[model samples]
Target: MILPCTSAAQDGWLRLRQALWPDCPEAEHLAEMAGFLREPDKYAQFVAYDEDGQAAGFAEAALRTDYVNGTETSPVAFLEGIYVAPQQRRQGWGRALVDAVTAWARTRGCRELASDALLDNVASHLMHRALGFEETERVVFFRKELS
Candidate 1:
């Protein structure tokens, strides 16, 4: 079953978030999730639970007013991240989480939903395609520092 992440489920969500982004500091994860807990309308996270009431996956999404790739509408629903346990993948949990986010976005009057994955993550690319996202463009970013 998919349900909105509650304040009481912060630790569960943290575990899933760390699994998806191991490089991110635990403190950073807590700070970010704290923002979600404070603002339910603009930010949202959903957790998928198994029959035994254990978290199996999660999706974090938000409303983005900035320019979003492949989107022609403003204030799009942007999927910040999603992860399903290796054992839970291919079982429709991921899709259900996305569906929940989509429903939430619709309630917020967003006309489109957008997401992105790293250039080298082929599995993520394929997953996005399976989730009905079409490729709009690919970009390789560069930066220069000046003092």
Candidate 2:
């Protein structure tokens, strides 16, 4: 089953988020989750549960008015992150989460959905393709610091 994340206290969502982004502190995760909840129209999140009612995965998406590479539409639904428990992968949990996010985006009048993965994460690339996303572009961001 797929469930929308209606509360920041939703442990399943937080747990999956931490699993996907292990480097982020719990406090930071909570803070960001709260922020997303406060903006329901701009952000959407979903959690997937197995038949046994255990959390299996989670996905977060945002409506971005700013330009998203490879997308031609404004206010595109951009998938921020998605994670399925290692033991739960290949079981359609990730697809369920993305489907939920896509439905939410449609309600918000978005015409397209966009997502990105690290260049080195080949698994993610394959998963995106399996989920019906086509490659748009490859970019390497550059930055410089000046005092």
Each model's lDDT comes to 0.89, 0.92
lDDT of 1 by residue, 1-147 (tens): 898977835546889999999999989988889888898989999999988888899999999988987899999999999999999889888889999998999999998989988999888899889988888889878999998
Report each candidate's C-alpha RMSD, comma-separated, in the order given.
1.4, 0.8
TM-score of 1: 0.93
Candidate 2 residue spans exceeding 4 A from truth: none
Error of 1 at 67 (Å): 0.9
Error of 1 at 24 (Å): 1.4
Lowest summed lDDT window (length 10), candidate 1: 3-12
**Cα misplacement distance, residue 9 of candidate 2 (Å):** 1.4
How does each model score on TM-score?
0.93, 0.97
What stretches of model 1 exceed 4 Å from their correct place?
A: none
